[model samples]
Target chain A: DTAVSQTPKYLVTQMGNDKSIKCEQNLGHDTMYWYKQDSKKFLKIMFSYNNKELIINETVPNRFSPKSPDKAHLNLHINSLELGDSAVYFCASSPQGHYGYTFGSGTRLTVV
Target chain B: SQQGEEDPQALSIQEGENATMNCSYKTSINNLQWYRQNSGRGLVHLILIRSNEREKHSGRLRVTLDTSKKSSSLLITASRAADTASYFCATERQGAQKLVFGQGTRLTINP
Candidate 1:
């Protein structure tokens, strides 16, 4: 079974369109994270939630919001997507007190 | 800002040869980890070395950490064609819950 799973493996949308990406983890981890990988293959952490509590919030724009209904699911909602929003979004989870993370395949979002 | 920077953005070597990748961080860290990512896939964790540890080995993968210099290195012996992938180094800073990743080094293993 896939430990971490993300929906909408590929997404293409117009500018100003809004969309959401869903992520789920069955590893029973306490912490979940969202990372953005640019075309240059630079990975950056966007947001982090530990047990449904917001713990880490980078300097990302307000257009991007992360919601975690529970410790098992974390979703990202982007409002008025811009051209710079086109990139691969990855979802990951790690157990409490554990440093290793399990990542999902990733969702490629394209804004045209 | 990126916390870690990898050296030799890209490297190509023949199969069975050894490959080495280096990572440098800006601040103190609790632990350093190496991950591998294939084309169109997510990253897979390889090994981790703590700040107090100097070296660690997992199978053919060897990792070394130097806390004084805030740097680390990963060495793979007898690299195979399947070893062609992007390698990234992530550091968990002291008192931080998030892991900051490096730009990544693309390794190509020629058969």
Candidate 2:
């Protein structure tokens, strides 16, 4: 079984359009996160939630918002997407205080 | 901002050869982890080394950590073509729960 799963493996939308990506983890982890991998292959953490509570919110733009309905699901909603939003987004989860994370297959977003 | 930076953004080697990747971090860490990502796939956890430990081995993978230098290295022995993937090093801070990742190193294993 896939431990971490993400919906919409690829997404293409026009500028100013809004989109949402869904992520779920079956590993029973307490913490989940969203990371963006740019063209340079730099993966940066955007947000993190533990037990459905926001814990870390990097200096990300206001257009990007993450919502966690429960400890098992974390979703990202992008408002008015821009060309700069084109990148691979990864969802990850880990047990609290654990060392490693289980990442889901990334969602490649393209804003035209 | 990312606290870890990987050296040699890309590497190429023949099959059965060894591949080495290095990562340097800025602050004290509780542990360091190595992850592998194939083309169009998610990151897979490979191995981890604690701050107190100096070296660790898992099958063909060897990891070394130097707390004084705030650096770590991952060595893959007898690498196969299937081992061709991007490698990233992530560090968990001493007290923080989030991990700071480095720009990955792309490794290409030529058959």
Candidate 3:
């Protein structure tokens, strides 16, 4: 079974369009994260939720919001997506106080 | 800006040859981890070394941590063609829940 899974493996949308990416983890982890990987392959943490509580919020724009209904699910909602939003979004989860993370395959988002 | 920086952004070597990548971080960290990502795939955890530990080994993967220099290195022996992937080093800072990743080193194993 896939420990971490993300929906919409590929997404293509136009500018000013809004979309959401869903992520779920069956590892029973306490912390879940959303990361953005740019064309250069530089990964950046966008948001983090531990047990459904917002813990880490980077300097991402307000257009990008992350909601975690529970510790097992974390979803990212982007409003008015811009051209710069074209990149791969990854979902990951780790157990409490653990240093290693299990990541999903990733969703490639392309904004035309 | 506690991100880790990896050296030799890219490396290419023949199969069965050894490959080494270095990572440098700005602040003290609780632990340092190495991950591998194949083309069009997610990152997979490889090995993790704690600040207090100097060296660790997992199969053919060897990792070393130097807290004084705030640097770490990952060495892979007998690299195979399937080992061709981007290697990233992430550091978990003290009192931080997030892991900061490096720019990554693209390793190409030629058959």
Candidate 4:
């Protein structure tokens, strides 16, 4: 059973376009997070939601927004995607704020 | 700006040998976690040690935490060629929901 899964394993789009990545976690975790891993392999947290409540939001661009319609799902939407938006996005979930996270395979986004 | 700093950025050893990696963090944390990541994949949680705990072990992995020194180490015994991967330490800051990861220590185990 896949604990965390993301749709559209790969995404390729042009600038000014919009794309969304969907994530689902059946681990029954209350907290879910989005992280971006750059070419340098530096992974940074972008956003985190707990029990469907937004908790942490790093200094992410306004073009990127995270929405959690329910506790089991969290989706990330990028508006007017730019070249800098190209990176691997990973979805992670934890039982609480301080537990080990179960991460998804990742969504490789390419913006041209 | 980096919270976790792993030493010896990379290491190479023969199969059956033990591999060790160290991680040092800047701030106080509720717990520290170790994760393994292959070349271009997602991270897999290995183990987690809370501030109150000193050591924890799982399978062939052993972790030790020293809160006073703000450091942690992961030791993998009986390494195999398949153990060649990057290991990272993630620190969950006290009261912070997000985890800060280290710059990873890449281990290359030779058969």
* Index of the highest-DockQ prediction: 3
What local distance difference test score does each model get? Answer: 0.96, 0.94, 0.96, 0.93
Across residues A6-107, which tens digit of lDDT does each residue of candidate 3 receive? 999999999999999999999999999999999999999999999999999999999999999989999999999999999999999999985699999999
Q: If you superpose only chain B onto the true chain B, what TM-score does each candidate give?
A: 0.99, 0.98, 0.98, 0.98
Question: What TM-score does chain A of each model score against the native chain A?
Answer: 0.98, 0.98, 0.98, 0.97
Clashing pairs in 3: none
lDDT of 4 by residue, B17-84 (tens): 99999999999999999999997788999999999999999999999999999999999999999999
Q: Is candidate 1 or candidate 4 better by DockQ?
A: 1
Instruction: Compute DockQ for each candidate against the true complex.
Output: 0.83, 0.85, 0.87, 0.79
The TM-score that candidate 4 achieves is 0.97
TM-score of the A chain in candidate 3: the value is 0.98
For candidate 2 chain A, the 10 contiguous residues with the lowest summed lDDT are A93-102
TM-score of each: 0.99, 0.98, 0.99, 0.97
Return the lDDT, model 4, position B1.
53
Q: How accurate is candidate 1 locally (lDDT)?
A: 0.96
State the displacement of the C-alpha of residue B63, model 3, in Å, after optimal TM-score superposition: 0.2
- Model 1, span B1-111: residue lDDT tens: 899999979999999999999999999999999999999999999998888899999999999999988899999999999999999999999999989999999999999
lDDT of 4 by residue, A1-112 (tens): 9589998899999999999999999989999999998887778999999999999999899999999999999999999999999999999999964679999989999999
Ranking of all predicted structures according to DockQ, beginning with the best and ending with the worst: 3, 2, 1, 4
For lDDT, the strongest prediction is 1
Name the runs in model 2 displaced over 4 angstroms: none
